[model samples]
Target chain A: MKLLEYQAKQRFAAAGIPVPPGRLARTPEEAAAAARELGRIAVKAQVPIGGRGKAGGIAVVDTPEEAQREAARILAMDIRGYPVRSVWCETGLSIDAELYLGITLDRDRRRLVIIFSAAGGMEIEQVAEEAPERIAKLWPDPFAGPQPFEIRRLAFAGLKHAPELHDRVPKLVSSLVGLTSRLYEVATSLDALTCEINPLVLTPEGNLVAADGKLEIDENADSRHKDIAEELARDETGDDGRSGDDPFEVEARKRGLTYVHLDGDIGCIGNGAGLTMNTLDLVKQHGGEPADFLDIGGGANAERVHNALEMVLLDPKVRGVFINIFGGITRGDEVARGIIAARDELHITKPLVVRMTGTMEEEGRKLLEEAGIVPAKTATGAAETIVQLTRAGSA
Target chain B: MSVLVDRSSRVLIQGITGREGSFHTAQMRAFGTNIVAGVSPGKGGTDQEGVPIFDTVADAVAATGADVSGIFVPPAFAADAIMESAAAGIELTVCITELIPVQDMIRAREFVIRSGHQLLGANCPGIVTPGQCKVGIIPNHINTPGPVGIVGRSGTLTYEVIQGLGQGGMGQTTSVGIGGDPVMGLSFPDVLQRFADDSETRAVVLIGEIGGSDEENAAAWIRGTGFDKPVVAFISGRTAPPGKRMGHAGAIISGNTGSAQSKLDALTAAGADIADTIEDVVRLTAVRLGTQPR
Candidate 1:
């Protein structure tokens, strides 16, 4: 649900948080065209990740020819596994100060927090680390949002270290008050878990403009904001999607399964998030690395189990599959039948190990045994068995 | 003697006519929970499995005197169900629905809090008191009433401890899944406080995962409150890669937080024994209790 930079800027603009004029360019020619129009533009990769500049995913070009060249290079670049499908060409800003502003959920407090910092831009890395007091946080009343008075105080606290801008304190405070409030509005309206404008530039002309932005919507809230979700969906597969998105994941998403790809040989599946994670940890503990984290999410049947197995084995790196089910709502027999069915129908030669427990597991255990698939006694035991099985197969 | 639920606690099903609601209703009833009423918006005045169905939580509460509500409504409608239960003055509302939008939860949680009631799990396995009452989907017959109080983030893992520990004759007073969702009701400290006050409970087994600061917060609460019970803590997701977006928040919220090591270190510093594996969780809790792992 992480929106790319251009998309986030659009939302920011709509919310009255001023952003530099930008055009999303899908090709080198588009970027060139954008440079011609915007004049002295910055071509940035449209990946939903940070540190793009360090990764060489961003380039500033004064000429349309240079813009095309940089865009071509960036568009072909793999910035942290996300293939750059497009670039954001924005009109360059004047020499000015950069500030950090963000709105996100403070999970511990169960409230929205406004993060403001006068120390922003590239020169200061780890501002929060090097100078913790510089970054001021204000938790808005969930029912009321941020008040103007509180926002001004936050602005003052965050600006305490930046004494260079002492003269325009009043104007800065007013700008921050308006910007943060609008960002909060965008956060609430979009069900944004994170709405950030890093290096919100204060221009030489005294105007505040968001230089870079990020907006990640809450996954659970997407159903309520279907339009937003679909409109700004991550180009997960690099074409009409974000890069680094595994085809298995795309398939899983389509089938309504929970799966995350990992770089290992043991394909892990479990009934719950904790159990699934434990499955991965157990594999690592047992001298085997996990290939993926897959949660069947309860009420598993033959079809779902088959789908999970297929999805896991789709990775050629997957040497073996281990399913750890501490069944509560999902029955053991159904899980066993699914495993057996997957084994038979998919013709999976990869060693499959299952540890099924809780709620009619005996029946499921009997079915697996009958199918010549032995169910392990414990999750640790299952991990041990799978690791051994995969080792033997690989060796 | 159970901290949250017992035989005498009257329970109502919010989405009584729905598939999950009807199915789990039977399950809960079979576990000896006193099923008093059901709330289905349009199916009022009808009875499903002999439990009278009311149009709203208020009407159901009025007729059946149900203090505890189990919500099985879909994610889209779950928040409304929670607020409905809260508004109707239900003392404890346990929502078993998962994936309810966080915004919806924030509002529901807010309403529940402002109304002076407790809401557990919009995406959680409901609380269960062994041999007395089972409110949500924790399997029945997994226990024989005893001394330990279990609070966990995972529903199935909670069942694991119950099956292993409880069946091994280390029965629990109650096992509550606070839920794995980052934004959830009844955190570790909140539940720990309950277990602290419960006279029947002697020890607690905390099953935590690698997200949010709940475990760290629980650790702090344990140390700060000087809680006397022997707490055997186990955390999952030791092998998880920190989620990119969530990791950013974690980095900003606190320095190098929301990892297994951080939670473990915090808990260890707070005088809680850590279990490396689920089996270790059972073995360590048994050792602390001066019993053999069964």
Candidate 2:
């Protein structure tokens, strides 16, 4: 679960990471009041995902009236697919230099890496690509945490060109290292997957502050962090920050199923994550683009399957449906019942090629046969059938 | 002998009293796995499926002399469960749990590495030697004993590929699902190395999805060592768009790295036949082994 910028910054500040004071404003009046107190402020759209600045979701204003106007404008606008529900009105900063600093789990290395560069703000990746030498990376030991020397090394390497930043940069880097240590503490303690601070700024006052923050907690590890879970639950009740989630995805989550929308004609559903991905690949290999990726997961009951099918069929672009279930912990018979129920209740006329095998296969196949739904013999065969049926229909 | 588990694999299920643990435990027993004991805190002294339950992995290990552990614990306690398995001196530990925090796994992995025990997955389907022993959640009936050995990241994709192998008159010696999490206990290279050593595995089928450099590392190993076995490979998520987590949390294309095209190029460079489709796996396996496809 991704925390909104304000939420991330709040956690960072609580962890002793210096951050520009910010208040969340839901209305133009609230924005004006916040700007009045802060004097010069930046109104940032409170959306979970990024690219807000290019989308005109960010506005910098000096006057309270201008802040209110910008807040109203941002709130009424739509950036990408997300609606601006709230504005993060924070005191604007005058920076001596912008330095990029962040820590992310390098999935390939299976370790935490601290990424540092002189070129900060957004476009850190672009900097890494253009001038690789400017960026310095350090892999911190999970147990020992990031050491002061390592941070100084990375800071000196990345910001060597700026002679003015020599004395202050080391201090900033040390604070960042401490902040990173705190971030790691929160990550391990709260079961967070990622904690990042982009553009850790060196102010004209020679103080360091995290200009932006992003923290993503692992949703599966929610049981361990009750406070965070409660906060997330409370956030979900209101607009919070999840503004652009498709209603279908939300419904699927409620029903204990996984769904991802895609731009294709064939709807694909499978019993496992790997199988679901393979099903999508198979669909494409057989000359059909997948409409969505849906995993019913193990031990799914009739209702889950019914809901999964219903959600997939909701996509009008889905000309054909393919269900690839190799039931192990998930009983084949329950899946068969769900498919039959979905076919009857939803009145699904589109072609559905199901290949159900393992764990009560006979019973499941019998149910499908009785429903006049001829199941495919193999996964590839099922994909072939769905592709053929959809192509034939289109022709 | 199979690469990981066989009739001799004394299997113990961690979190055995839980829903997934109990369910797959029963499946493993039915598939002829030597189910020796189970471990679930506070559920000790209780018996389920006629197997002994213990309070700790150490107790379970001491009582049953179990050498292999299959974990089905929740993500929060998954790292502890793995550490427990390793601490108990289990030779091999297979974790079926998913969504373990990367930091926890990093620590767990470091601990396990120090302990010198092999960990299979934090989100894998485990290993199965068809008609001999089955561990983890990979469906038991999807496979049968043969000369082909399989190693993969995704559970259901492995099952689908198993079915494809079967449909092509090829059966598996042992199919190991290393899991689709960012961090894995046993990686593609580890599994491939085991498969190469096993006499029963005349040919190996490698299944990988987008994300991570495990496949690339395995490819480099194959190229460096000039592995003798005819390894056939299939990479999923060719059409997967970047930034979308396709069911598996680990199966996402990030930037220029972790692309299907990149993995395919690496695998091809390492002298492995690529399967574009599920059916292509069988065809490539047949061609590599100098046999006619059924």
Candidate 3:
């Protein structure tokens, strides 16, 4: 669950981290009111995605009238796929330097990592590649908070050339260390996957403030954080209880099925995660674009299979459906019955190529043949057939 | 002759009274796994499926001498269950539950490794020795005892590879699913090293997906260690879009990292035969093992 910038900044400020005073404005009037409250302001488009600054979603204005104009302009624009619903009017700061500070779990290393760089305002990956030496990484003891010395070493390296800023750097580093510890606690308590503060700016007054913030909590941990979950639900769905959510995905989740919407014409459904991924790969390899990734999981009956098919057919882009199920604990015959039932009920006109192997596959194939759908003998053959069928249909 | 669990290994099922636990316990017992006892908190002194029940792993171990634990507990309690099993000095613990918080797993992993007990997965299919012993939920009927060894980060896809091998008359010595979680007990190289030492295992089939650097690390290990056995590899999620989680929590492509193509290239460059599909895995395994493909 990705948090909007306003939410992230709110969390950051509440954790005792210094942030530019900001208020979320939903309209031009609200923007003007906020601008009046905070003289010089930065009207930032409140969206979940990055590159908002480069996309012209952020506007710096000196007066209330200018702030309202900028807010109206940003609100009318779209960044990536999301519409700019609101703008964050924040007090514009006089920054001396832009630095980076982020705490994220390194999935490969299986440890908590803190990334700090003197060179900020660009993607961390680019900084890592272009000037690796400027960035300092520290793997802090998760059980024991990061020591002051460890924090100082990374922070001092960024401000090493300036002898005048040496005294303030330690204070800044200590404060950052304190902020990071609190941030880690918040992340652990909420089971957040990442907490990032990019371009943590340094002011001439020797103050460090977070200019931008991003927090992504794990969806699986949402149940444990009910308030956060409810908050996100309200924000995403709006008060009217409807948004740009895919109906198929919403229905699939309700039915306890795993479904991901994707672009392309081939609807791929398989029994397991590995097999489903392999099915999608094979489909694309055979020149078919996979419309979605769906895993029906183990032991599916007629009703579940019907649900799976209906979800696939719900996507207008899907010209063909590929059901590549390798039944181990899942019985193939039952799956076949579900597919046929869904096909009949939904009045599906799209082509479906199935490759049902293992555990009573013959019975499943017999049922498919009876329904005038020929099952492929091999996984590769099924993938190829689906691609060909979709191409033929398009032609 | 098998890696990890064998016929003589006494097995205890955690969360035995739960729906998934009860079903898999029967399946494991049916496949000739030594059913010693079960552990479900507050359900001790009772029996489920003729296996004696204990409230804790320590009690179960004391009574049944069960050295291996197959966890079927819910995600919330999975970490504690793993730690409990490790504290009891169980030699091998296989966790079938998925979606345990990564933070919890890190702590649990540290404890398990410190205790010298191996943890397989928070989300995994467990290990199986064809016609010998079955631990978790991999369907036992598809396997046959032979020379080829299989290790994977997936459940049913590994099963598919095993089935393909069986269909092509290439039976397996042992097949291990290292689990799909980002943090797991044993990795591809860990299982690969064990397979290398086991004489019953001749050729190996490695199934990897587009996530983590496990496959690349396994390849590097293979190259460095100079393992002589033939290894065939199959990497899934070649078509997976970047930043999309593909069912498994750990199986996602972030930026330029954890791509299937990168994993495949690394494995191939390290001298592992790349199997384009499950059927291709069968053919490659047969060729590597000096067996005629059916």
Estimate the TM-score of every prediction.
0.93, 0.93, 0.92
Q: Write the per-residue lDDT of candidate 3 for residues B26-125, one digit (tens) a residue.
A: 8888889888999999989999867999999999999889999999998899999999999998999999888788878877887898898899987888
Residue B113 lDDT (model 2): 84
Model 2: per-residue Cα lDDT over A1-395, one tens digit each: 77778888888888888899888898999999999999999999977777888889999999999999999999898776667778999999998888777767777678778788777886777987888888888888777877777777876787776566777765666666676577666666666776777777878877878888888876666566667657756655222334566776666677667788888999999988777888888888778999999988767898889999998988788898999998766788899999999999999999989999977788999999999998898887888899999999999
Q: What is the TM-score of chain B in candidate 1?
A: 0.95
Sort all candidates by lDDT, best to worst.
Answer: 3, 1, 2
Candidates' C-alpha lDDT: 0.85, 0.84, 0.85
Candidate 2 Cα outliers beyond 4 Å, as residue runs: A160-164, A167-170, A223-247, A391-395
**In model 2 chain B, which range of ten residues has the least summed lDDT?**
B136-145
TM-score of 2: 0.93
- List each model's interface RMSD: 3.3, 1.9, 2.0
List fnat, each candidate.
0.62, 0.76, 0.63
Please give the lDDT score for candidate 2.
Answer: 0.84
Instruction: Point out the higher-scoring one by lDDT: 1 or 2.
Output: 1
